[model samples]
Target chain A: MNAQFRRRIASAALIIGFFVAWELLCLAFNVKDIVLPRPSQIIVTLIERIPAIWPHAVQTLYTTLVGFALGIAFGVLIGVVIGSSRLAYDVAYPLLVGFSSIPKVAVVPIFVLWFGAGTVPAVLTAMILCIFPIVVNVATGLATTEPELEDVMRALKASKLDILLNVGLPRTMPYFFASLKVAVTQAFVGTVIAETVASNRGIGNLMMIASSSFDVPLVFAGLLILAALGVALYVIFSFIEMRVTGWARRKDEFALG
Target chain B: MLAPPSAPPHAETYVALERVTHTYGRDDRQVKALDETNLKIDKGDFIALVGPSGCGKSTILKLVTGLLTASSGYVFVAGREVGAEPVRVGIAFQNPTLLPWLTLRDNVMLPLKIVPPFRQEYHAKRRTEFRDRVDALLDQVGLGGFGSKYPWQLSGGMMQRASLCRALVHEPQLLMLDEPFGALDQFTREELWAIMQELWIAHRPTVLLVTHDLKEAAYLANRICVMQARPGRIIDDTIVLFPRPRTIAISFDPRFVALTQRLRELIVVASPPKDSNP
Candidate 1:
């Protein structure tokens, strides 16, 4: 078998082995399902309750995606502004740092007070969380463009806008993609935080309700679904990143065996 | 020393720097990079500015290309004053500054997409025509089939060749080369010099090449300007009398050797002393 296939097999074996060990450990101890549910019990609960849980899962996915999309759009806009001009960067950077430093969880209540316990708070939080890294990275990418390349453009009598469009934006793709990966994960966190405290629907709310009834396996199932969703989104972004900015990656970075 | 002939601002003077001076920074931090530097390059002349580091060879180029305005005096190109508008010049630097993301063909076509006249027609279904020009230039530089490849995939020598094509693809009137072969190894550098000579001969652009290598200056340029550092100014201008289609064999010629040696002596005398080892 090829090394990549072998590596994939090894990973699958490791995950399956861990679950088998968890099952046996719980059985030997005769542990109560309340204290900690076995992997098998959690999986069974997930399967049994999936019909009732489907809508909540969809709700969580929708909120996270909406928030993430808004976050990316807002982040890229701020990034371009801060990145292109010295004055904007200087004026906006300190305020952005202070705002990003404020715990996103703390702002959910204020969002609830303004927009009232719903999807808006989640999106705003996700968007705010995403803006910092994207702005910092995009600005850095534009600022670091080679002066020699800029001179090349200037020699051709290209305008400032033309220079930015031709050289500045394309060069920022690698940095922008890097920030996207970080921001996507943060988007999920923001959505879940808002859902648990304020929303009547979604996986976070389902988990909170399950925990109150001491349906521990159901809570674990909710956690499992969120993890899967996060992984799915992350993987999709990674694929797109490769397609867009593969030129920036060194071929030897992933050595073939 | 024979007095250099004064340029009378003739119609054929494609580029002229009349007592131009350039200073970097401002006030106490100010440092003079060029001082009353006067140069005249004819419409089709190929000239090399040879000097030690910090001798303002590059500064002169920046001024001519209108990337930097002179601190004093007139800088003229194509009989018009430079500055207040960008000059249409093609530039290639030592690093082969190709956009990593673009295919070699796309990079070569970049000037047409941005420069006036060509850019006006760039989006109007003339893309195929521009692509043909890019391909033709690529073929000339021996990168015929490699146009679709990204610059990162190419070897250093190949990338530099592509850089040359990008600089010349627009058929610019002035070509500014700032140590375009400085980063290459000896064999690669010589090979590029021959290619450079052919390109210049094909379509003569009033060329200003800044180089540290005296032999490279002697091989490529019809006239060589030797400059002195610390408020830099040209110390000597020697005209090379070599015939066209000069080959590598001609570098061994006694006259060629004497010319390089003379330029070397002028630089060595003017350059500052190195830090002594105790």
Candidate 2:
């Protein structure tokens, strides 16, 4: 097999082996479900209760996606402003850094206080949590445009806007997509944080309710569902990133061991 | 088919630098890159500037292209002073600088889509026409079939050839090259020199080439100017009387060797003392 296919098979085997070990270890030690539910038990619960849990899954996904989209829009706008001007970079970047360093969960309650503890609070939390990385990556991408290329554009008599659109944006795609992968995971964290604290819906709320009632398997099932959704979104974004910025990436090459 | 002549012969000088001075950095760190440098080129002339590394060969190009304003005096192109707004010029550098994301065709066609007169109607009606122009230039540079490839897919020589096509695709009145072939291997450089000669004969832009290679200056340029470092200014100007479509074999000719030798001697004289430490 080719190295890529072989590598993929190895990865799959590792994941399946981990779960198998988890199942065997739990059964051998007679582990209590309250402390750590078996993977098999979680899977069974996930399949059996999927119908009841479907709505919460949908709610969490929708909120995270909306917040992530808004985060990207605002992040790119701010990034462009800061990246294109040295004064703005010097002035605004420090404030942005300070804002980002504040633990997002701490701000979730503030969002709750203003927006009344529902989808709005969850979305705002998700957006604020994810904006920092995207802003930083986009600004870096814009800032790193090659001086030689800039000379080419300048000699063409291109305006600043033209250079940004034709050169800067294309050059920024790989960085932007990289930020998206990281930002998407952060968005999920933001949504779940707000959801568990205040919302009556979503996987986070369902998990909280299940735990309080001692439905340990159900809580594990919720965690599994969140992980699956996260992986799916990551995969989707990775695929799109590959399509949009293929030129920037090197083709895979075989290496000798 | 080649496009019609972009410039009709005119009595007025097409490019003129009148006592232009350019200083880099500010205050204590300031260094004069070019000092009261004066040059003039008639329409469709090929000129070469040869000097040591710090002699401001590139500074002169930046001024003519309007990328930088002269610290003092006037820089003129196409009968207008160059400042604030850049004058139309096609430029290439030591690096190919092709956008990795763009296909060779798209990279070459970039100028048409950006420069004003063509950009105003680039997509409306002239895309295919512009594509044809790009293809023709690529063909001239021996990169015709490779137009669909990305810059990274090509060899360094091919990329530099594409860069040349991009510079000329817009048919700017002036063509500025700053050590464009400096990075190529000897064989590749010689091959490109022949190709460059063909392109100039076909397009006839008022070409200004900057190089350290005295042979390159003698082979391609009809007029060669040698500059001195430290408050850089031209010290000698010589007109080459070689016939059109000069071949690579001409480098062996006694006259060509003498010309290059003369330019070499001038550069060595102008070079700063070897022992002087900054």
Candidate 3:
């Protein structure tokens, strides 16, 4: 078998072995359901509650996706504005750093007060949490263009915008893709936190409702489902990163374009 | 390849620096990098400026390319005053600085897509023709099949070769080299020196190469100018007078060794004495 195939199978085996050991240990220790449930019990509950759980999972996915889009659009827009101009970078960067330092969870109540307890608060929370990294990464990528390359461009009589278009934007792709991967995962976390505090729709709300009734197995299942969704979104972004920014990537990272 | 409209039909002085002095910082902390340096190159002349580090060899190159303005001198290139607007000039540095995201072909074609007269029609009916030109230039530099490869896929020497192609692709009337082959291995540097000479011979862009290597200066340039230490200015000018198609064998000739030895001794003499605080 190829090395990649062998590595994949070995990793899969380790994950499966971990769960098997966890299940056996749970029974051997006679662990209580409220504290921790066996993996098998969680799996059975997930299958039985699939129909009821699917809608909440879909709602969480929708909110996170919508908020993620908002973060990327505005984050990149603001990032480019700040990155391309020295004045904007100097003025906006400090303000952004100060703003990102404030916890998004602390601002959830404010968003709820403005938009009410629903998807709006959840989406806004996700956007607020995820936008910082995107802005910082994009701005850094655009700002750190090799000065020597800039010299070459200037010698050719290229204007600033011309240099930015031909070199700056393409150079930012790897950083941009890396930011997307991190931001997508952070978006899910933001959505869940908002739903736990202010919303009534997502898998976060479902977990809250289930735990309140002491349905411990169902709560674990909801968490597992959210994790799966997060992983799925991250994989999608990674796949697109490989396709679009292949030239910027190392061979071990993916492969040269 | 369209020539820059500014080029004069009967220009004698392609690049000239008249009493150029450049100061780096402001006020008391200011450092004079180049002090009243003067140089003039006729059309299609190839010259090398040899000096120790921080001797302002690079400052002169930057002045001619309009990367930095002279503190108090009249700099001219292609018959226009420097610092007015950027003129058509090609430059290569020690680092290839090829964009990692671009294929070698795309990297070479970059200047064409940016500079004026050619940029006006880069993507219209001239796209295929431009591609062919880039291919031809790459082939000329021993990088024929490597055009589709990205920068990382190529060795450092290959990358530098591509860089030379990129600098020349726009067909600028003047080419500047700031230690273009200094970072490569010894063998690769010698090989690239030959390639550079061939390129210069084929398309004689008025050239100015700034380097620390005396042998490199002797082997490539028609005239070698040695500079003094800090606040650099040329102290000696020696004409090589070597016949064309000059090969590596010339370095072993008695006259070649003597010339390189003399230039080396001059550099040592020009080096500043160390501080004697004891």
Top candidate by TM-score:
2
True contacts kept of each: 0.89, 0.86, 0.89
Name the weakest run of 10 consecutive residues (lDDT summed) in model 1 chain A: A248-257
Give me the runs in candidate 2 sitting further than 4 Å from their true place. A252-257, B1-11, B83-86, B275-278
- Per-residue lDDT of model 2, residues B1-278, tens digit only: 22222333454588899999999999999999999988998778889999988999999998898778889999888877875335568999999999988888999989988997889879974557787888888998899788878888889999999999988888877899999999999999999999998889887888999998888888898789999998899999988877767788888989889889888888888887871334
Cα lDDT, all candidates: 0.87, 0.88, 0.87
Q: Candidate 1's residue-wise lDDT over A75-162, tens digit each? A: 8888888888778888888998898788888988999999998778877777777767888889888878888999999999989999
Q: What is the lDDT of residue B178 in candidate 1?
A: 98
TM-scores for all candidates: the values are 0.93, 0.95, 0.92
Better of 2 and 3 by lDDT: 2
The DockQ figures for the candidates are 0.65, 0.60, 0.73
Instruction: Write one digit per residue (lDDT tens) for candidate 3, span B81-133.
Output: 97564566899999999988777888999988888788988987345888899
What TM-score would you give candidate 1 relative to the actual structure?
0.93
Among residues 3 or more apart in sequence or in different chains, the pairs in candidate 1 whose N, CA or C atoms overlap within 3 Å are none
Clashes of 1: 0
The window of 10 residues in a row where model 3 chain A has the poorest summed lDDT is A248-257
**Native RMSD of candidate 2 (Å):** 3.9
